[model samples]
Target: MTAREPRLLVVDDQALVRSGIVGLLEAAGLEVMGEASDGFEAIEQARRLRPEVVLMDIRMPGLDGIEATARLMAMPEPPRVLVLTTFDLDEYVYRALQVGASGFLLKDAPPDRLVDAVRTVARGEALLAPALTRRLIERYLAAPAPGVLAAPATELTPREREVWQLIAEGLSNHEIGARLYLSEATVKAHLTRLFVKLDVRDRVQAVVVAYESGLVRPGAQRATH
Candidate 1:
């Protein structure tokens, strides 16, 4: 039996960009569920299509992408959103994360990178590109939040805390598994535990807790994945 491809919704005002992304994603053997030309349409299509991932643009006509993303996330079972935009739209990257986007990507990301992003989101992993991840975090820190250490320290088990620290350092499940000499399933179990204990939706938010809670210090060298 053939494996079913993950369904994707490509949302961009630019027809060419949407088409190109759909083509790249489909060529990589994933399913393109639908396409939308604007944020309003994207939200409507996402509801109807029930895609696993929504490749969304930051700026769009009518409702902006950030608002659309926020609204979508409020759904009963929302799809993961990947902020895919051009270099000129980097300003919106931080806002996209604030709106609960699971990851960020360049519209010009290589074909493999785009494919990998779809797979990552389908697997319930955050799509934080290493470069964009740091940039988005720095933007948040520069403004300085009220330092809400929302994730309580005692809620995390000793093993779960170790996993959370590694996540803050940007380690993937496979890398964490290898480092701890545990199976990937064990690593994922720990991650799930951490997420529940912290009430976080993804690793991006977990990293925020790490910083706010002083679990991981800024400027500290993270383990290379």
Candidate 2:
């Protein structure tokens, strides 16, 4: 394994939850930098610790995960947020993505799921399996407001557009490469170009831009996989 294990911050109101998550991550050879009890504290800890990923809870006394996510994202080098909460319903997922959460996972996610989510978020990718709920995307599009994306025109190519659509729909790079009849390396290359063109740092940002900029819509008919 690479020596560069990701640093993680666990944020939840419950002490047991934070402790358990920290144990699991540390066992997986990742660093657990700190833990926070609520969104406000999560923000404070993140500002000080600057971990690579945050395991966030959606609801808390002072600040909710969504609000915390927005605050974290405002930082110049914000950590990737992996929301671990029950707010996976449509509205929350939409808003979470809008505010730049890297992925959503249930608090009850299996051990492997939690590990996978952390790894995915650390690598700047979104997960297909939402941590919070299954119907979140559907709920989000019921009354859609155009999302704000930082991407500009004259950046992405047409093939990159296709890739972006798939990416927003939560396909991994290998899957996208297969769908596009390109190798994973080729897909990564395309993604690199897309990232540079879009001025985004990672896959989460790419997906957000794709959806908010109207490149892909949750209401659209699903394409054949």
Candidate 3:
């Protein structure tokens, strides 16, 4: 049987931008399940439609994308949220990642890139490369922020610590498996253990922890899968 297309919800405050994104996504053969003009509407639509991916714009009025991402992630079987932002350095993008967004896309990203972003997030992978994400986190860390501490990695086993460091290096599960001479399943298991031990919601957060704990450093070699 043919697989179902990924269902998506496009959220942006501007009517023209929302319409354009919806059109582009549909043109790429994705199912545009819904459109939300603001974050509150996004939550309501998400609750009702349960789309596979949410393309969220960050600067919406009342209930910004970061807050909405936090709320949606709290739901049972929440849809993956891919933040849409005008600026890569926008602090809210980092906050969105903290709130459990699967990843992010630039508002002006090309159509093909946008389609790929949606597909990437829908497939349960992060949209941003590890190195880029780490850079963003580094910027966030350089600036003073409350409640941004990385949870300690003291509980991690040595093997788990190795896996965490590799993850911080931006290796994918498959790459980590090959490097460690383990199966992909085993790598995923290691990541799961790290998440539970570190109390992080996703790999992005885990990488953040690695940086905050000094397990990984800026200008270190980044391996992109």
Tell me the whole-model lDDT of each prediction, alpha carbons only. Answer: 0.80, 0.76, 0.85
Question: Taking the tens digit of each residue's C-alpha lDDT, what string does model 1 give over 64-118?
Answer: 8899999999999999998887762365777777667887887777899889887
Name the TM-score of candidate 3: 0.86
- Regarding lDDT, does 2 or 3 come out ahead? 3
List the lowest-lDDT window of 10 residues for candidate 1. 142-151
lDDT of 2 by residue, 1-225 (tens): 754878889998989878998888888778899999999999999999999999988777889888999999999999998888654464665677668887777777788878888887788776645212224554554433555344473466889878877876767778898888999988999888988888776776676566557666656664444
> What shift in Å separates residue 121 of candidate 2 from its native position after superposition?
1.4
Full ranking by TM-score:
3, 1, 2
lDDT of candidate 3 over 41-136, digit per residue (tens): 999999999999999999989988989999999999999999999997778898888889988878888999999888888877777866678779
Q: Which pairs of residues collide in model 2?
A: 88-132, 88-133, 90-136, 104-131, 105-131, 106-131
The superposed Cα distance between candidate 1 and the true structure at residue 172, in angstroms, equals 2.4
Candidate 3: where is the Cα deviation over 4 Å? 142-152, 217-225
Q: What TM-score do all the candidates reach, one by one?
A: 0.86, 0.82, 0.86
Span of 10 residues, lowest total lDDT, candidate 3 = 142-151
- Clash tally, candidates in order: 0, 6, 0
TM-score of candidate 2 versus the correct structure, residues matched by position: 0.82
